[model samples]
Target: MIGKLGATTVAILLSGSVMAAAAERVEVFSTSGCGCCIGWIRHLEEAGFEVTNENLAMADLYAKKTGAGLKPGQTSCHTGFVGGYVVEGHVPATQVKRLLAEKPDAVGITVPDMPAGSPGMGESDEPYEVLLVARDGSTSVFARYPLAEDASR
Candidate 1:
């Protein structure tokens, strides 16, 4: 009985470790000179993601985004991959977590061009949308953030 319990506990622990490791693994492709990109990375780190930063030309990143099925309007400054999904632009870490958790049927998510107040841009004067890029290349708003009337609100 003791041996069986030990084996089950070990299995549970291993599964938990695997899930944690998978959650932390994120590969980011961006330019070395982009401060906002770094800021976004920091946001991910704060949200418990382990980042693997790769220095690539802007063109390369764009190519990867396009290759990953991101349309022109459905792209941002940086590109990331985790759990077989492409993460584009300055998408919030919470959204990213939700993406992993929900495992939606689509290409992945994008914040389009770097939007203000979207995790790394500080404050946004206008609303922004996080788009869900479908496998067929159609995009729809997955998440919308409305700017507060007070500007700082």
Candidate 2:
């Protein structure tokens, strides 16, 4: 019984660690000079994401976004890819995790036009929306920020 219990405990611990590592990997593309993008990357890292980033020219970055199926209105300064989904803009890390958990059948999510008080955009009383962009370029509100509980953050 003791040996069986020990084996089960080890299996559980290893599975948790492996899953966390695999689930948190994200790849980002942005301009090297974009400070806000850097901050956003930091935000993901703080949320336990394993981030790998590449800097591109603005034109190249835009191309990358387009290639990722992000339309003009859905664009942001930086773009990220994780778990077969695209992430655009200053979207909160929590929302990203939620997206992964829900596994929506959409192209990805975006926070259009870097809103203040977003994950890396500093604090603000202004509210913002995270849009879930569909494969055909339609968007719907995926999440909203500055919730009553989040005001303290």
Candidate 3:
């Protein structure tokens, strides 16, 4: 129970908001034309994250992503930063919170390509994986969603 709210009917409430307030705000970099990127932004907002967006050209965006030490296959529709970690693709806010909480040694987390069932990606009922790209460029499964097993490259 948070903010005088009961557990009952909590489904209609924004639990993410409670979690969001203490969470790190995110800085996003993406092309303004990508609808999925916008959706991802909305997802963050709904999760109670204070997100600042920067629209950059594809070349510039790619430059930033790579400059941040991101590797190939870890690329996604967009990039974001929270705390000291980079967030790539339509990563779930829950995972972001987990990442921040764990404070892992990594460049960031990525959902790979625009998997149909990913956060911003449209409905595909496909499974996907969120990969935590370590600082050394090695990768590991950070989190798994039954319907989210195919996203991370």
lDDT of 1 by residue, 6-47 (tens): 988988988998987886589999988889889889989988
What is the TM-score of each predicted model, taking all chains together?
Answer: 0.86, 0.88, 0.79
Candidate 2: tens digits of C-alpha lDDT, residues 1-153: 548779889889889989867977999999888889988999999888999999999999999899989988898899999988999999988889989989999999999989998977887878889999999999999888777865432
Model 3 over residues 1-153: C-alpha lDDT tens digits? Answer: 555666655745566655556457899999988999988888888777889999999999999889888888889979998887899998887888889888988898988888776777766667788899998988899977643343321
Best by lDDT: 2
Q: Which candidate should be chosen as best, given TM-score against the real structure?
A: 2
Better of 2 and 3 by TM-score: 2
Q: List the residue pairs that clash in candidate 1.
A: none
Count clashing pairs, candidate 2: 0
* lDDT (Cα, 0-100) at 25 in candidate 1: 89
Deviation in angstroms for 30 in model 2? 0.6
